[model samples]
Target: MPQSPTAHDPNDIQEFNLDAVAGILQDEKLDYRIDEHDGEKVIRTGFINAAISFILLDGSLTMEAMWRGAPSTDAAAQVLAATNEWNLTQFAPTIRFFELNEGTLAINALRHVVVSAGMSHNQVGSYVMSSIESAVQCFEWLEQQFPDLVTWKDEHHDH
Candidate 1:
């Protein structure tokens, strides 16, 4: 026997909006402020001694965490090796090394959420928190694996 189709209420369809995302973050008790760079919405938050920037786009949201200081060019090969190793193991947020001004190496953690598929508010919050946690994990991993290349900031500061 075939099952009956469920009713499709209009409310079942969700419209992904920046304001909604912000509200969800607020509801989840995350302290964040919205900033716009060149008219693109960016949610700025801090976690685990690193600054997090969440970019609100049409169909997706991206969270990026940058390290405090850059490493010297001599450690670029090590950084690349770490990036490759982490990328092969991790699936959610990714780690990458960037060449900053003066040829210094900067490690960054990136997490992206595709919202066009209709994610719930809880799901969004989980994504944001997951990204934040990923940043912390990546930072700690680097500190443990490449202590010579990365100098960790003082964790004495409040979270």
Candidate 2:
């Protein structure tokens, strides 16, 4: 005797919408606010007020965390070196050094995933959680390099 085919689960066929994204975040009790940028809705939230921006595109989502007032002067060189090393070694959360101000440099850790076709609620949750976790991990690793990267704002106060 042969076995019969089973139907696909509806729970797995989830639509990628801001509301669904918020629902997932709400379920985790994480505070998130929706903001519109260029007519696209984005999710803004954080870990310990570190600040992370979530960009939801047609079939993709991205997470960006910036370390303001990061390495400067002598430290800038070291951070550039470390950033090159991290980018060359790590696989997740691509890191980059940017000059946001006149001289100070900021570090950005970014992660992205494509989900335009659609996904299950659980899949969406995993994608969102993974993005946040990886971003935080990247920030933590950089902090280990400079130790004071976490206090960039507290010490500067002018940013």
Candidate 3:
């Protein structure tokens, strides 16, 4: 007879770590590096020239994608309107706009996940992939909305 499926224990828990994140990235065939920033482990990955970071913490993960297509200050109002619309409608990544300089308005796609009760490998992987996919869609929509105004500013390349 086929073996009975095993049930996942609700009490099974462990500190969320970069090793798991690395595995997820590898399984997805995405190139990434686990690095330290202010003593916290971060998994860095790139989509084209855009940079995305996965921050590891106890029972939690935060993904932030630094969008390369930043709008100029002259179009700040338009950018803000687009962000407002996205926030009001979408469910995945949260968009935050910051005035990086007098001329450039930068935006980041941020998502936070908390699994205090622990999660399965596949569950976590779903969250990781979905986060990336949503951010990409958001950037694409914004670019389409302002094709001429959007300017690329890859943070990884400036230095």
Best by TM-score: 3
TM-score of each: 0.78, 0.79, 0.81
List the candidate 2 regions with Cα displacement exceeding 4 Å: 1-11, 152-159
On a 0 to 100 scale, what is the lDDT of residue 92 in model 1? 54
Tell me the lDDT of candidate 3. 0.81
Estimate, for each residue in 83-126, the C-alpha lDDT of model 3 and write its tens digit.
99999999979998999988898889999889666666776788
lDDT of each: 0.76, 0.76, 0.81
Per-candidate RMSD vs. true structure?
6.5, 6.9, 6.2
Across 71-143, the per-residue lDDT of candidate 1 in tens digits comes to 7878788888988998999885787877777868778888877878776656666777788888888787877
When summed lDDT is taken over every stretch of 10 residues in candidate 3, the lowest stretch is: 8-17
Q: Single out the weakest 10-residue window by summed lDDT for candidate 2.
A: 149-158
Pairs that collide, model 3: none
TM-score of 3: 0.81
Candidate 1, lDDT over the whole model: 0.76
Between candidates 1 and 3, which one is better according to lDDT?
3
Off by over 4 Å in 1: 1-13, 149-159
lDDT (0-100) at residue 23 of candidate 1? Answer: 74
For TM-score, candidate 1 versus 2, the one ahead is: 2
